[model samples]
Target: MIRKLLLILFGMGCVALQGQLAYEGVVLDADTGTPIPFVNIGIVDRGVGTISNENGEFLLEFRPREVQQGDIVRISSLGYIPRKIPVSLLNDDVLKLIIRLQPNPVSLEEVVLTDKEYVEVEDEVGYRDLLGKGIGYWKDSVALGGELASKIRVRKGLRRLNTLFFNVLHNPSDSVRLRVNIYEPADKWGAPGKNLNESGRSILHVLRSHEILTVIDLKPYNIWVRDDFIVSLELLGVFGTENISLSLPAGNLPGVPSHRRYTSQGSWERIDDSAVGFWLQSTFYTDKPRKANKPRQLRKREKKEREISGTVFEIISSGRSEMRSRRRGATISNYTSNKSVKTDEWGRFRIKAVKGDILGVSYPGMYQVLTKVEEISFYNFQLYPVKN
Candidate 1:
């Protein structure tokens, strides 16, 4: 009976699922008639989805009670046209349906080169520090082609990316294959739009057992863009149970927001305004960035933001700039008062903490620290950057 259920779950048996609906199919190229692997197949925003494996086969099962009216299965892939089939029509078809996706490749026009004044500049940008624990399907099996992307700001003029770096955070699988994609901002919403990778070949990387940090060389692809763009990593295949996450704790890296799309051709959904946790090595022929707003002097700032009736602990950097980078917005939690406050530019924060109250401080790139309030005169706090 267990073997029979397995066959039914994989769409091999004729018996229909009791309380679930399963869509099984093999996605193929319409022109070449070859199996198209890693195709996205699922209903929009329903969280009911699956991706075609390397052989172009997939099985997507969902509870029929969970689907709302007008929901359709969206089948999509990079450089291919998307197809939608209504939920009611899927049950009418025979099991193991064959899907053909037409190629709708967008062309990149050739342009003539001209000599112009150019400044060659390069810098590294991304959320390298562990601000939070981890983001994504923290510890669960996820469909193939599920992507987690972060928006990266670039300078004016053309920018070329050479290296892309991100952390796995948690991967229960022994190995997981991933694809790197760089996209121009979508016109209507400024979300991840057109695929900027000119090469027809997919940019692929493999994370082996015990490996955490991943760095991919993008110099060969010659990826160049003028405006800000999004960098995303797509799940291709997992050797074991598919459990992974890219999010971190800390809640720092405020400006960059992360974006997510469940499967190939699915709609892009903004996960949160929080960090995306991916950075890159950027080279551009553009002028320096505009000067930022002048920072308010730390001492001159008004302390009247809140009334503090307890000891004031100054979080000083232990000769590391990482401590200062997160100084202004670092989180200071007063477990005693059941309240929290952000640190000022000088890494100083005042909270209501009496004797024996526990205080926890968090900053990017530094280990989280907790202190038990002692004598008022001995409240000196110092922190160092976290080592890799």
Candidate 2:
């Protein structure tokens, strides 16, 4: 009689295990039958979700009382079509299934060009220098890991974007791989919205150490901006080495607002205090001219007798007195010739000018200063803070 009771208790435990609700699955490419990683899986109309691991395997658990019969599970990825299956279709016991996603086919638009000349929409006048530091995935901070985005508006229609330019600085021992994504604004809140590129379509570049300007050709992608768009650079982490950091050169300028950066692949937040590095110089051309064009003769300006060198510094106001520090990445413009160059990291700049030639010096958060090139070789200027 005791042995029979023991057998009955073991049977009850087995039945309880079978009644638990759990789902485990592997995501793969439908055509190749290969594993796919980073696929987002979630319950339909429910916030519960998880992403596939590197091995393309995922496990989701539900309480026996909370799961419904007709509930749906959805899985989606960047380049594949999303798939959904009903909970009632799964097995009551340990449900294990293999789900496959088909590749999304992207259709390209036709291009027709009737004009050879193009106009510059935005120009990167090197002005400010700010470094974006790297933070881990979870920590909420400035210039951390994830994506940084900026907005650009197109005033005219039928303009095709030809090129994009930006700058980067990285460690000499490591190489960084990054992706450039263009998106249409979701709303007027100045946030990055839906991606404009087709599924899996992106511009990837490998960056090395030192300051270098990166130029990407967007013509093959046929990306045309109608009203305005957002440009984002995604840091995919460093390759070949570990524990290395990469940063982009950012600046502050009048008429240009502070850009936005997102952390841990999450929502977009504006960088309220400073402008993030990298300039977006977009060249656009239209097939038809909006107005008639007329040729005009250009005027020639006189040459300067000497070149002057200088160091720019910013005045930081404290409680009583003020302190001055090197103004890195300031723009020194020769107003006579309309030529400009950025100051080095040490805030030192050298430009050709005469005694009477005017030098326009400007940096973000400081008032513009125009100083006449005095008969001095080494001139120094201090930029005052803007009044509140």
Candidate 3:
């Protein structure tokens, strides 16, 4: 009997040692077909876990007994949909799982372009900084009860070619409006006669205006690509108009030189002469700022306007200079205070009202957005294509 017990104990030790199991695969976005790095992979019962690498690949190990063929393997991450697969059904040692994640449907306080001039083939749409940390942009003075706020920039290396997205949030009760305004810089590269040129392509004239705002939806996943519409027009041969080029247009090659030339001959006049402008501005708001402790003054003759009106949201293009730009006579409306103002060439604007009042800000070609008046000025802005 003692001998039998010793044999049984030895058998148990062998079972424990033989329980090692391994799994490998890549996790990616099912919708856009993009890879998701740092995803968490785990065995449900064994408490074993592993992380996906930069390529969204992972290798996980488990005790053979703890995770059987029919057991479940779980995979998940932020800004993505989670998934669980049956281990028994997975036949291959290497698995490629495309896990689609929906965009977070939260209010976007700000959008940041990690790389000032990002150019990459991959889709780098999600926010990269540590969650909850962001920078804000404002247009008005934060001192004199202005609605203008600060600008927000994200911290990441966004591929130069990938289109960046910004998510803005608003109270469900508040009406959040968005207008897309595109401002394209006229051919600053070319003289009335001499065309600007850096490469084979001549900056003789504006070949095609670069579109500034691609996606301008206040809601999630509701992206409207106007470029696609333009392409469809060219394809369908909608109207007889200006010159059109059919030779394959360039894919998003960030920092890659453009091939099209303004002049018939492929010659450039200047070393670094590219003339274009894409001006964008947005107007939005949060809760108003607190009033100063000083006593209030009342005007005896005229009706006094509130110190803070509504909040203003503004975002301008990155590459262009603010000096050459200006905002003129744009109107600001409120139930209590109806006013009109224009930004200087730098795309600046101002409004006045007491804190807590709702202000609606709108520009000629931009989406109109509303924000509460705050003592601390805010800047909400969007980019619009500048037409010739």
Candidate 4:
């Protein structure tokens, strides 16, 4: 009887010591209506805290007995000043806190380019002509108009992945990596650690300082696959740079993609003015089209003629009819009319070309070119080795 009584008393005591407590709030930029993310929030006295998710909301749980109405809460984050507010002010079990973070002042040292140092060409006419050409290749149709479109059937066999849209600055010497995060509708989705918000932030960090591309040609431009929304950092600066001139090929810029179906929301475009060039996104809308007709099986004899492969190198002005010869100990190669030729250890190669035929050179997607051959001979051609 005594044991039973003791057990009842202990249970009551435990219940009495516990109280229900919860903290909820919306975090926003004090200056703008933007929601603040990844900010750290904590109850200073109890040593408990939580970070705000992408939606700028945070929830922290505590036993009411462990926290009082008058405790102080601390909030902080990078690129922003921290603040503390009294718990008593957290009225009605829900709170709205507006925080303002000052932007970091950037200070770059002025660097001068001397006459001895070469400068690239940058004019509106040059790039405009280049991008206007039909540039890349898809499965069947050739890519055109600085935009590409293809009807993709999202069947059961297709992999499920997040759709993304991207735009870039082009230069000959740089490569940019872009990352994006998408947030699910807050009303319908709860905070998931692996959601788009974190992914976008991670990508932004990598894009801070990237290498730029110095040149471009057309052959590699056709090699871009449909899945690549990630723009290369190397080609970004080519669109426009201080004193740099961009020379586009005779046709259009290949591989700029557009939606095949009118159902898509829309895509992005590069907007340029006399002063600068930037990217703007368009709204994409699409309707479900009828199932596509199955393509007829192809005959084995009918094969694809397009072949893309090569190493990166520079073209020297030394050659009278062609680019300069490859240097010693080179590993790069160039595409010829009939077959591709690789450089020897000493960077020498004897390759064949036909008069009036086009010879394409390529390196990654950064640069490529198709040259019209006046004559086919070893004497007219040379190669440069690629270090990048």
Best by TM-score: 1
> For candidate 3, lDDT tens digit of each residue in 133-166?
3222222111110111111121222212112223
What tens-digit string does per-residue lDDT give for candidate 4 at 1-388? 3122111121111122245455555567655758777555666636356556668776655565656777867665434556676666544423334444433333344887644422221111112223333332212111111112211112222122221222123323222222222222122112111122211122221222232212222221112121212221111111122322222122322332222211011122221111111111111112223212222321211242333322334465444665644443332322222245554554454544444334544433223344545544433233433436
How much does candidate 1 score in TM-score?
Answer: 0.62
**Which of the numbered candidates is closest to the native, going by highest lDDT?**
1
After superposition, candidate 4 runs with Cα above 4 Å error = 1-18, 68-70, 93-388
**Candidate 2: deviation at residue 190, Å?**
1.9
Candidate 4 to truth, TM? 0.25
TM-score, every prediction = 0.62, 0.47, 0.24, 0.25
Whichever of 1 and 4 has more lDDT, that candidate is 1
Query: Model 4, residue 193: what's the lDDT?
Result: 15
In model 2, the runs with Cα more than 4 Å from the true position are 1-27, 35-78, 82-99, 105-145, 170-173, 253-265, 272-283, 287-388
In order, what is each prediction's RMSD in angstroms?
A: 15.2, 15.7, 24.6, 21.5
Q: List the residue pairs that clash in candidate 2.
A: 127-329, 249-277, 250-277
lDDT of 2 by residue, 290-317 (tens): 5212112111122334667889999999
